[model samples]
Target: MRHDASRRRFLTIALVTAATAPIALRAASAEAAAPAALPKLPATDAAAKALAYTENAAAVKHAAFKAGSSCTNCNFFKGAKGQAYGPCTLFPKNTVAAKGWCSAWAKKL
Candidate 1:
């Protein structure tokens, strides 16, 4: 009875591991294969002006623009690995320039 219990426990562990291993591996690979970073948005875009966006944060003219803040360092930036442009939560379906700045920029935690 002892041997039977041990064998059953081992089989259960093995089955569970086998079932979950593929899922774990697939998730890892999917992360590795994600799309490259998006293109930088034009500073002249209407939306850019509305948000007081600037390719260079230091160049922003808005009274609320902070001198040292930039999109690359903002919480809203979702840049991909090694790229200068990425999607911003503030601008759905549009990319923000990495060096850009906006009034909505928030320091990434």
Candidate 2:
């Protein structure tokens, strides 16, 4: 009886661990998959300068700049609607102002 009780306890522990292991791993992976916060891009940044980036689209001096073109409508923009700033594919690890404009801007489909 004693040996049977110990075996049952061990089997119970093993089953519980097996059942929960995947759940625990999934939780850990979800945390790891979370995106790190991106920093706002500065207008004076070298990349920004090369792209003629302006925080305000209306202030852009590039000849190709459209009157209504802005980061919020750009293909590269990854920010949520109404946000002040968000990530851009052109400037990894940095975010652009929603109202900003750059030479690399492509109309979002």
Best by TM-score: 2
Query: Once model 1 is optimally superposed onto the true structure by TM-score, how far is the C-alpha of residue 29 displaced, in angstroms?
Result: 10
User: How high is each candidate's TM-score?
Assistant: 0.59, 0.75
Q: What lDDT score is found at residue 16 in candidate 1?
A: 100
Per residue, candidate 1 scores C-alpha lDDT tens digits across 1-109 of 9999999999999999999999999999999999775456776778877888877776778888777888888999987756677899987657877888988888899
Candidate 1 stretches greater than 4 Å from native: 1-37, 80-82
Residue 71 lDDT in candidate 1: 87
Scored against the true structure, residue 104 in model 2 reaches a CA lDDT of 92
lDDT (10s digit) by residue, model 2, range 7-32: 99999999999999999999999999
Question: What shift in Å separates residue 43 of candidate 1 from its native position after superposition?
Answer: 2.9
Error of 2 at 6 (Å): 14
Reference-based lDDT, each prediction: 0.83, 0.93
TM-score of 2: 0.75
